[model samples]
Every structure is written in C-alpha cells, then in structure tokens.
Target: MSKKVENLLRDICFRIKVKGREVLKEFPITPAQFDLMQKLYFAGEQTMTELSRMLGIAKSTTTGLVSRLENEGFVERKRRKNDKRIIIVVLTKKGEYVIDKVIFKRIEFVEEVLKDFDNNSKEVLVSLLEKLNNSVKRRGG
Candidate 1:
C-alpha cells in the first residue's frame, strides 16, 4: 500500500511539473527563472546567497539568473544600506504582474483538471494534500 501510494504521488508530482512547464512556455520566463521569481515573490527580497541556498544552486548561477531577470525588468538588485556589499534581489511590479497572471492561469488549469470532481471530493483532496504538505514540512523537507 505504501509503495503504491508513493508511486502515485511521484507520478502526480511529475505530471504536475510537466504541465507547469508546458503552461509556462506561453510566458516570458523560463522554468528556472519562474522558480526563482516565485521564491522571491513569496519569500520577499533576499540576498544572492540566500536565494542560492534556497534554490540549491551556486552563487554564480544565481548571479546570472538575477542579471537576466534584472535586464528583463522582472527583478532589481539593491545594496543594503548598512552594508554596501550585500545585494538583495526584489521582484519589480512587472515581475509581480507576470507572476499573478501565471498563477491565475495555473489555477484555471487546475480547476479544469478537477472539474469532474464534486465539491466534497475537492474538499477531501484539499484536506489530504494539506495534511501531506504539513507532514513533509514537519519532516524538514
């Protein structure tokens, strides 16, 4: 039972990721950029080091990503007032706009996917997913 549940979860996660990538193709940013931007959007402004650590990428890679985002007007970097060396990356208004649109589209897609499910089923699914998420977080994922 555990193995089957694990396999199902893995497949669902993979399918969701693939679908997300397909949907993002209509947007201006790549998957990596979208991921970074999403993190910044939810987590607020963060230093390059913090972003790199959060994304599990190298500092140089984060720098390049930030540079591209800055050039595209999706993000901006500013030096900390107390320390000129620390650079914080923040999402711009344009970035916020893009994220909002992308998220709305994604939600719409999910709603379509779950359209067949009744309200009670959706409520149960939401509860179970939330429980699973909380468990994963508690385990320090």
Candidate 2:
C-alpha cells in the first residue's frame, strides 16, 4: 500500500512538472532561472552567498544565474545599506508578474484536472496532502 502510494505521488509530481514546463514555454526564462526567481519571490531578498547556499549550487553558478536574471530585468542586485559589501538579489516587478502568471496557469491546470471531483472529495484530498506534507517535514524530507 505504501509502495502504491509512493508511485502515485511520484507520477502525479511528474505530471505536474511536465505541465509546469509547458507553461514555462511561454516565458523567456529557463526553468532554472524561474526556480531562482521563485526562491527570491518567496524568501524575499537574499545575498549572493545565501542564494547559492539555498539553491545548493556553486557561487559561480549562482552568479551566472543572477547575471542573466539581472540582464533580463527580472532581478536586480542591491548593496546593503549598512553593510555596503553585501549584495542582495531582489525580484523586480517583471519577475513578480512572471511568477504570478506561471502560478495562475499551474492552478488553472490543477482546477481543470479536479473539475470532476466533488467538493467534499477535494477537501479531503487537500487535508490528506497537507497531513502528508507535515509528516514529510517532520521527517526532514
């Protein structure tokens, strides 16, 4: 039963990723860049080192990603006011707009897929997923 549940979750995740990539096709940024933007969008501004650590990538790689995002006007690097040496990456309005649209599209896809599910069923599913998510977090996953 656990194995079946794992497989189903994996398959569902894969399908969602495929759909996300399809939605990303309309954007100018690559998936990796979009991921970086998402990190910033949710976590607020972060220093270059912090971004690299959070993304689990090398500083040089993070720099390159930041460069591209900066060039595209999706993000900007700002020097800390007190600590002028530290530079933080900030998401621009353009970046926020892209993130919003991408999330909206993904939600629309999910809505279409769940169109046939009754309200009670949908609520139950959400509750189960939330419980699963909490369990995973407790396990440090």
Candidate 3:
C-alpha cells in the first residue's frame, strides 16, 4: 500500500479505538475489563500466568484486574482439582450477563457508525477485514 493509504487507514483505526473507549465509559465495564471477559468467555478457564501471558500484561497487573472483577462478582477463582497450588479464573453468571449486554451494544455501535455505507461497500469492508485478520494470524503464527 502507498504511504497515503497506510496513513489514512491508521488514522481511521485510531479514531475508532478512541471513540469505542469513550463510548464504553457509560457501560459497567471498561475496555480492558471487557477484553479480559471476552477472552475468558471464549477460551474457558485459564491460570493467572496464562491469562497474563495472553494479555501481555504483568502478573501483578493481571492480579489487580482479576481482583476487581471478582469483587464485582463477574469472575470467580478456583483451585484446580488436580493441582492445589494452581488457581484458574472462571466467569460467573453475572459476567455472562454483562458480557452479553456489552457485546450487543458494541455491535449496535458499529452498525450505527456504518449506517451510511452502501450494501456493497459494507460487504467489501467486512470481507477485507476478515481477510486481513486471517492473513495477520497466519503470518504471526
């Protein structure tokens, strides 16, 4: 891609990220909390070390986030049946409820943002995003 095209894409993505964070301020969860919940929701229970690695955050920071979520009744920590020394994080029913609402609102926001786009443009944008995501994953892996 040309420099101008790359710059334009970067700016658009940055704006979307900033706006999304701003919008989430009104919700019960912050962007980072939503990220953790989404990861746990899809990947199932994980150890603190594993979650920290997956999130690329330090264990101390992960601990704080986990603590806050637990206090909110959105997450629960449990000792493994086989390993008493290890603790895994699990999502509570409250977490599931909040996540469902958050996800639906997020999708709604995106839909509102794209309402001006024509059908063909919308399809092309979605296809390109999927292709780009897959390509990045393949290259990274």
Candidate 4:
C-alpha cells in the first residue's frame, strides 16, 4: 500500500507537470506569461512593484515581462488617477479572451486526466491539493 501510494504521488506530479507543458504549447504565450496574466487577472490592476512582489520576481524582470505583455496586447498600463507617476497594469479585452481560452483548454486537460476518478476521489484529490497548496505557502514557495 505504501508503494502504491508513492507511485500514485510520483505519477500524479510528473504527469501534471508534463501535461501542463504539453497542453500549453497551443498558446502563444509562455508559461511564465500565463502565470503573470493569471495573477493580474485574478488580483486586478497592480503596479510593477506589486506584481513583482507577488510573483517573487525581480523588479527588472517584471518590467520586461510587463513590456512583452503590453506589446503582445495582453496587458496595458494605465496611469493612476491619484498619482500620475504610478502606472497600473490592466488586462486588455484581448488579454482576457486569451486567458479564458487558455484556462478552458487547461481545464479540459485536467478533466481528461481525472475522467476515471470517482466523485469521492475527486473531492479527496481537491482536498489533498488544497493541503499541498497550504504547505507550499507555508514554505514560501
């Protein structure tokens, strides 16, 4: 039983990583870009510093990512109404559309992966994942 559990864990992790990369190939943006988009989309508009801090990336690296996102029309900078010096990054309509599509595809991939799972198993899987997420946060991942 222990060996079975270990195999299950290893296979689950490896498959998710490989399958995520494989399915993401159809998208124009890299995984990093999608990650940033997700952060911006979920968190709303943020300054470069805010995004950098959230992503745990350097300020200059965030700047380049923002630049590429802007040029690709995935994101745009909006000047703050209160402060002209601070620019808030906002996702454009195109950005939102791409994000939605990418998310749908990713979801489909997950659905495929878990198609054989029973309802109880699915719930357990989600619970375990939540625990894992908490662990990562605790470890400052």
Candidate 5:
C-alpha cells in the first residue's frame, strides 16, 4: 500500500513537471534559470554565494545564471547598503510574473484533471495530502 502510494505521488509529480516544462516553452528561460528564479521568488533576495549554496551549484555557475537573467530583465544585482562589496540578487517584476504564470498554469492543469472529483472527495484529498506533507516534514524530508 505504501509502495503504491509512493509510486502514485512520483507519477503525479512527473506529470506536473512535464506540464511546467511545457509552460516554460512559452518563456525565454532555461530550466536552470527558472529554478534560480523560483528560489529567488520564494526565498527573497540572496547573495550569489547563498544562491550557489541553495542551488547546490558553484559560484561561477550562479554568476553565469544571474548574468543571463539580468540580460533578460528578469533579475538585477544590487549592492548592500552597509557593504558595497556584497551583491544581492533581486527578482524583477518580470521574474515574478513568470513564476506566477507558471504556477497558475500548473494549477489550471490540476483543476482540469480533478474536474470530475466531487467537492467532498477533493476536500478529503487535500486533507490527506496536508497530513502526509506534515509527516514528511516531521521526518525531515
């Protein structure tokens, strides 16, 4: 039963990822760049070092990704007020818009897939998923 549940969750995540990539096709960004933007969007502004650590990539790679995002007007680098040497990467309005649109499209896809589910079933599913998510967090997953 647990194995079946795990497989179902994995398959659902894969489908969502495929849908996200399809949405990304309409944007002018790569998966890596989108990932960086998502991190910035959720975690707020971060230094290149912090981003590299969070993304598990090298500083040089983060720098390159930031450069491309900056060129595309999706993000900007600004020096900290107290320290001119510390550069923080900030997501621009364009970056936020991209993230918002991608998430909205993903939600739309999920809604379409669940259209046949009754309201009570949907509510119960949400409750179970929330419980599962809390359990995963408790396990440090």
Candidate 6:
C-alpha cells in the first residue's frame, strides 16, 4: 500500500511539473531556470556553493546556470561584503517579474485542473497535503 501510494504521489508530481512546463512555454526561461528562481524567490539570497548543494548539482554546474540566468537578466551575483571570495546570487527585478508571472500561470492552470472540486474538497486536500508535508519534514525528507 505504501509503495502504491508513493508511486501515485510521484506520478502526480511529475504530471504537475510537466503541466508547469507547458505553462512556461511562452516564457524565455526553462524548467531548470524556473526551479532555481523559485528557490531564490522563497529562500532569499544564497551563496553559489549553498545553491549548488541545495540543488544537488556540482559547483561548476551551478556557475553555468547562474551565468545563463545572469545573461538573461534573471539573476545577479554579488561578492560578500567582508569576503570577496564568497559569491551570493540574488534575483533581479526582471527575475522577480518572470517568477511572479510563472507562478501566476501555474496557479491558474492548477485552478482549472481543480475546478471540479468543491471548496470543501479543496480545503481537505490542502489540509491533507500539509499534514503529509509536515510528516515528511519531520522524517528529514
């Protein structure tokens, strides 16, 4: 039962992600860029090393990603105040705008997908998902 539930959850997540990519089709950003931007939007500024670790990618890969984002005016890298060796990245105004639009589009798509659900059903779903999320966090997932 647990394995079935896990598989179902993975399938659901993958579908949602694919739908999100579809929603981003009109935008210049890719899913990878969106994921990185989303993290910055929620997690605030972070060093390149930290971002790489969090994204489970190599430092060089993170640098390449940041380079692309920077070139597109989506993000900017800054040297730490006291430590020039440390590079912290932050989203630019353009980056924020793209992220906001992408998020709104994703939410709109989800609303359409969930339109058949009643308010109570939606609320219950949210509650259950939150519970599961909290449990996952507690278990270090």
Best by TM-score: 5
Off by more than 4 A, model 3: 2-31
All candidates' lDDT scores? Answer: 0.87, 0.91, 0.82, 0.83, 0.94, 0.85
Per-prediction TM-score:
0.85, 0.90, 0.76, 0.71, 0.92, 0.87
**lDDT by residue for model 4 (19-43), tens:** 5556456656777877788898889
Q: Rank the candidates by TM-score, best first.
A: 5, 2, 6, 1, 3, 4
Clashing pairs in 4: none
Q: Model 2 over residues 1-141: C-alpha lDDT tens digits?
A: 999999999998878766766767776798889889999999999998999999999999999999999998999999999999989999999999888887787788899999989999999999999999999999999
**Winner of 3 and 5 under TM-score:** 5
For model 6, residues 25-103, the per-residue Cα lDDT tens digits are 7667877778888889999999988888888889898888889999988999999899999889999998888778766
Task: Report lDDT (Cα) of residue 3, candidate 1.
Answer: 98
lDDT of 1 at 9: 90
Candidate 2 residue runs with Cα over 4 Å from true position: none
Candidate RMSDs in Å, in order, are 2.0, 1.6, 2.9, 3.9, 1.4, 1.8
Off by over 4 Å in 1: none
Please list the residue runs of candidate 4 whose C-alpha ends up more than 4 Å from where it truly belongs after superposition: 1-27, 123-141
Enumerate residue pairs that collide in model 2: none
For candidate 6, give the lDDT of residue 64: 86
Q: Write the per-residue lDDT of candidate 1 for residues 2-45, one digit (tens) a residue.
A: 89989999987676666656656666687889889999999999
lDDT of 3 by residue, 38-131 (tens): 7899899999998999899999988888998899888999999999899999999988876666566566778898999999999999999889
Better of 1 and 2 by TM-score: 2
